[model samples]
Target: MMDQPNPVRVGHKGAKVSWRKSSYSGSNGDCVELAELGNSVALRDSKDRQGPVVSVGWRTMTTFVSALKGGHMGAGQA
Candidate 1:
């Protein structure tokens, strides 16, 4: 069996991070913000820049996106 990495939680810090909206996002303004920190990637809600963040390794982020695209991630069963 392989070891699974624990989830990351990023929040409650006064530090500043440069976050940008995804280019693929629409002009509706409901989007997510992304920021890079060395090997880690941080994501947060565009509507709440000061809200909680979800950070993960660059590789992990890639895998997650892939899963999303492949329809491998979702709530419950379809």
Candidate 2:
């Protein structure tokens, strides 16, 4: 299994996070928004802006994105 960083709550630290959606997202509303919070990054469903948020370290977020781009992450074969 892949190691993952523990999620952090979006408290006062991220109360004012400026979230942005990827330009690749379609109008289907199956997209997520990302916000940079200093050393950490926050992610939330774009359709549910006030819903739950997942927070992880900046390095972890970058690594995860790289893995996704390289097709190293998927449903199985961890």
Candidate 3:
């Protein structure tokens, strides 16, 4: 079996990254941010800018976002 890419990958040695927040996010607070770097997508908490980053593939990210919008992944469930 091939090794799958990890969902989380931390940047080291001062790599330049451009972060962006979701447009659907509320102004009050509480949102998730995304950053597209090459073929990878980075996710981070809006409240905590300096928090841990989770990196995923573009296709995987698209599927996850689509599922989220389609309500396929409900709360309180894995």
lDDT of each: 0.74, 0.79, 0.76
Selected candidate, larger TM-score, 1 vs 2: 2
Q: Better model by TM-score, 1 or 3?
A: 3
Q: Candidate 2 — which residues are off by over 4 angstroms?
A: 1-15, 75-78
lDDT of 2: 0.79
Query: Which candidate order results from sorting by lDDT in descending order?
Result: 2, 3, 1
lDDT of 1 at 8: 49
Q: Against the true structure, whose lDDT is highest?
A: 2
TM-score of each: 0.66, 0.77, 0.73
Per-residue accuracy of model 2 over 1-78 as CA lDDT, tens digit each = 444655555656546667899998899999988888887888888887768888788778888999988988883465
Report the lDDT tens digits of candidate 3 across residue range 1-78: 322456565566788777788777788888888888798888888888777777878888778779888889995577
lDDT of 2 at 54: 83
Candidate 1 C-alpha lDDT tens digits along 1-78: 322444345543765667788788898888988888787888888887767777777788888889887889983567
Model 3 shows how many backbone clashes?
0
Q: Which residue pairs collide in model 2, if any?
A: none
User: Any idea what lDDT model 3 has?
Assistant: 0.76
